[model samples]
Target chain A: MGGKVAVIDYGMGNLHSVASALEHVGAGEVLVTHDAAVIAEADRVVFPGVGAIRDCMAEIRRLRCDELLRSALVEQHKPVLAICVGMQALLQRSDENEGVDCLSLIDGEVRYFGNPLTDSEGTRLKVPHMGWNEVQQMKAHPLWAGIADRTRFYFVHSYYVAATDREMVAASVDYGVSADAALARDNLFAVQFHPEKSATAGLTLLKNFVNWNGQC
Target chain B: MALAKRIIPCLDVENGRVVKGVNFVDIRDAGDPVEIAQRYNDQGADEVTFLDITASHEGRDTTVHTVERIAEQVFIPLTVGGGIRSVDDIRTMLNAGADKVSINTAAIHNPELVRDAAQRFGSQCIVVAIDAKRVGDVDGQPRYEIFTHGGRKPTGIDAVAWARKMADLGAGEILLTSMDRDGTKNGFELGVTRAITDAVEIPVIASGGVGNLDHLVDGVLEGGADAVLAASIFHFGEYTVPEAKAYMAARGIEVRL
Candidate 1:
């Protein structure tokens, strides 16, 4: 199959790195573009980010790429992979920006680090949880192909998706509580970590996403 | 569950090829950084740290070129250090596709550099590298001193205290190397490693004295290091990155196996 991966460049994310990584992993025609027509023609789409959730969503809205992306995922049934803040944008709303609405691709809310219900651990655990951490795989999925049981992906984010349904969650990690690290439903998949920065394991995951058989 | 430990291969560069041994001496060319980084990336290295040991004195930063080249080929995170003294330098490296920029001597000389970089680019982009030596002292306490100019000049700063201070100053990660044990291949300084790891809330990468896979595990489990960094073993192809991860996995250390 002729595969063209369109890396959405909405002006608020690391577009080049994600494009380079997909190209390195042998994706045919890794295009970095904000144009809606270019995104519509691609076989797959990768939304990569490393900044504020609201800012990224704003850029997507400004470029009118949000409707294009939403249509691609919901109507076209094309595979969509969201990384880092890009994944957070899949949530309905984020607490980071005071009730800013996300794309609402997944049924969840993005809340900041630290549990308001329980503060027994104190404030030692800083916000924007950075560095390598383990994500426990939940259910079997094509996106996790070749990934080990407890794969450690590099995460750098302050907010997490409190997914509404357990079935929609693909993977989770402990950050004071079991939080959704990955979410998938039908043709859509989102990860809270930077796969381009997660090294080989991350590359393998991306490869799986590109080669997924749509057997979700 | 415990956080998965990272296995990193550090390359000390002079000119373009990888070099080994302490104080940047007894150097042997270990191939191009692009080639080596690709090999490590293919073999599943969690990340790669490149120390441009000669960039400062050469009055030029080769990391930008290195990052540009490797960024074109390798997909994993590439952290560039050495001779990074200002925000402009960090921006140049980041623009070249570096995931993180590590500052050692500059962060020591001016602590605000760390805070400034972290503020502008976020803490995830800032990594503070510390080189320490085991000085013979009372109570056999291993002091964490900062080594500069390729581990030539001793900064005399306590490593543990410095690590805590750097974390407070907005350093997202600490890349701590043992100057005394570097290139020795005997083993990592567990006491020195633990002191810094325990002192700081951020992740600590233990560098220096990794002879085999066992040493990597020891550095993580015994030394309390979040990650282990090695040069000679990986540079000389004594063990591939997969072998190191496999070994760590067998030791029951949570690694990306």
Candidate 2:
């Protein structure tokens, strides 16, 4: 329940709130930093982002944090969390901005949750998918520890993750179709939902992330 | 699964402190903003809105600091409104840890502000708050106009049309407050609320005129708002957030329980 948690800030996220959430969850020495060296040394790295994908990928490449993240994941094997646009950035490409390249850290593509979105039961759903939805756990992972299955989590996004490898998808929630909600591979865990802004279940998930061992 | 309905608690603060005296309840001196926010969060409030009712220029800074304090304590979605005029104001509040910023009069003056904020910070963070009052009847039918300056200056703009325009301009949500029902504690103006809700596809938070628990239920059931925001009833502790959720849940409303 305690470890140095560094939130990767690229000038376009709710960094302060994410850092505060970690602090509130009893994490030790939570730091919101863009310094590659600081993020490289932290016990856990949370790459938090909001806004558009074009600007997000632009900033990630501009600051060379992309390279830092590459090494952090492949070389150091640190437990890393990507949220919202941060999660989108980890994919190969996104349909946003008419098609933008991404970090390709995971086996997925960032796609727009089509206009006139509707759920499985033929019920109409809204774009942006703002608010809380129940996430069905697809795999038993440590990050979900202390959290009940199908607990609701707050989300605010217009794009969703479409992963090619089904084994890597840790959870998928239905909204028109079964949308991949969480992707887990090795030390990397990326979620389309904002854990910091989500209520009790969110807090518990972050607490679990802080205490995770980065094992499968 | 359908998205759960939200319960939002609105706090009107003046000069950095929460303006007390709701009715028949003790809060121990207006209760600290941070403490009150935490209590609401624990009570299962989906979101908490802070309205800076300070007229003085200096009170703006006080509200900003209060948002900073409350943000550190409360983890749920925190929306800060009142006196938000420009993109800089929105950025300042966001940096201070507000998840979203609600704009009123300024948006009316410069309608482009909503589009600008939506483009810059995404539509999910921009909440266009419309204060509406029913104008003179036209042929046995009621017409609502947008009001500003504490609901004093009438813009003569149709509320339902403005709500549609706000959504067209890329606003994520609409916070509709009825001037007639505000502070009345009678009930929400479902006629206007449903009109706006039906006109726009975006999320709408029906605010004002929440007296009893049924009023909250009516806001969602009758008005069809995505969220319900109440002030006095919650501020005075007439009913807790969970109690309201339970009430709504029993009525078959999908709320996060």
Candidate 3:
């Protein structure tokens, strides 16, 4: 039987597109639902978000998804993927929202792209760093199974994860400093960028997640 | 290490569908906005730009409903433009779930609109779009001229200088389109893209004249564009987003693939 993939829908994500992407990447079955029972039965889970981190976390908490998500990642040890704000929600805290604690899957905080770097001409680079950017792989992981180093991915976030442990970072991308792009610890894999929006390399990553053997 | 850049797919929407043409003529129907957008979203498009090409000509409000519909379906960011002549229009799109609003004709007419939008909605929500063409000057400088009114009117304004002005006005991003190379599939106007990229502090999204993946890569690497936008190849299914990204990655352009 094909493995079941559950995409958490807290009424904040683009559920249709995420489901379509997972299905396209070879997920045997994709379910976009917030029901606890369905999530508990899934072989793998995905958390996708597009809007504010504060609101997403609020919805997850409202639906009591935080506890279930923790169980899935920490106890069940099912492969989990977090996209964009979903990734930020895996952090400890976010500056965007004061005192907002993320799922704490990775030890880090999210901060805005503070103070633009001036070029030789003394012009301040723009903030919110929207558009396609390149990321350098920091270590090998199944999430990046078919991707190479220096791969470009589509990004649109203003805040990024500042993981305390450098070893947890699977990849780093240059915005001003080497910002953590993706993180991994055992079965929990989260990306600051949207793999669902990263194109083929992203699809490869999703395919890898769907096919991963649950090894760190 | 810089942050990962984004790759955006722009759809020139008329009514409720995506449309494109050569030199803005003989506009051919592309496809359903939602379907095409879903395809891009699935293929890993970082964001999508929906320009209401006919809103002004038709004397209607911006395509807020269409933007809302697309936003509801896609999880990635959505930027809505075309006929965004006033701050009210920007607010309407944002309320409908647009992450950003692109101002082209309006900003060209009233330059302060950029600043006002930035002040009201934060700079990150404002995008100034410029359609430029290369014109020969008397001094042989080969200057870039800004075009307004859906690229039919010439303002005699220097493209590079106008980009600087927009930045001064607090435009969060610049969507720079090359009128000459648009839909020609020859490639983007590298000189135009580079000039704007060098002049603007904000991210520059290179639009117009993307025929292949190499053109996309050139827009980012050689043209200095943070993101590349195209419609024809993507609408016609010539290349999927993943395929284009893979091509860019293969060419050392640093795509997400």
Per-model CA lDDT versus the true structure = 0.81, 0.85, 0.80
User: Worst ten-residue run, lDDT, model 3 chain A?
Assistant: A118-127
Q: Score residue B173 of candidate 1 by CA lDDT.
A: 91
Which candidate has the top score in TM-score? 2
Candidate 1 Cα outliers beyond 4 Å, as residue runs = A52-68, A71-77, A95-103, A112-137, A140-158, A174-176, A197-201, A211-215, B59-62, B134-142, B212-214
- Give per-residue CA lDDT, model 2, range B1-257, as digits (tens): 56888999888777766763222122224656788899999998999998775532444677888899988978899999988989989999999999999998889999999999988888889999999998878898789999986677899899999999999998989999998888778889898888888788788999878899899889888898889998778877899999999999999888988
Q: Please, what are the lDDT tens digits per residue for candidate 2 over residues A57-102?
A: 8888998879878887889998988888888899999998899999
Ranking by DockQ, best first? 2, 1, 3
Task: Write one digit per residue (lDDT tens) for candidate 3, span A28-68.
Answer: 98998889899999999998876667778888999988887
Query: Can you write out model 3's per-residue Cα lDDT over B116-216, one digit (the tens) per residue?
Result: 88766656678899999988764865799999765788999999999999988888889999998987999999998998898777789899999988898
- Greater-lDDT candidate between 2 and 3: 2
Tens digits of lDDT, candidate 1, B1-257? 54567778888888877877554677777888999998898788878888888888775546577778888777667889989999988888887888889999998889999998876666777899998886667476655677776678987888788989998888889998888788788889888998887787777889888888888989988898888899889888799888888888888987766
Give candidate 3's TM-score. Answer: 0.68
lDDT of residue B76 for candidate 2: 93
Give interface RMSD (Å), model 1: 3.2
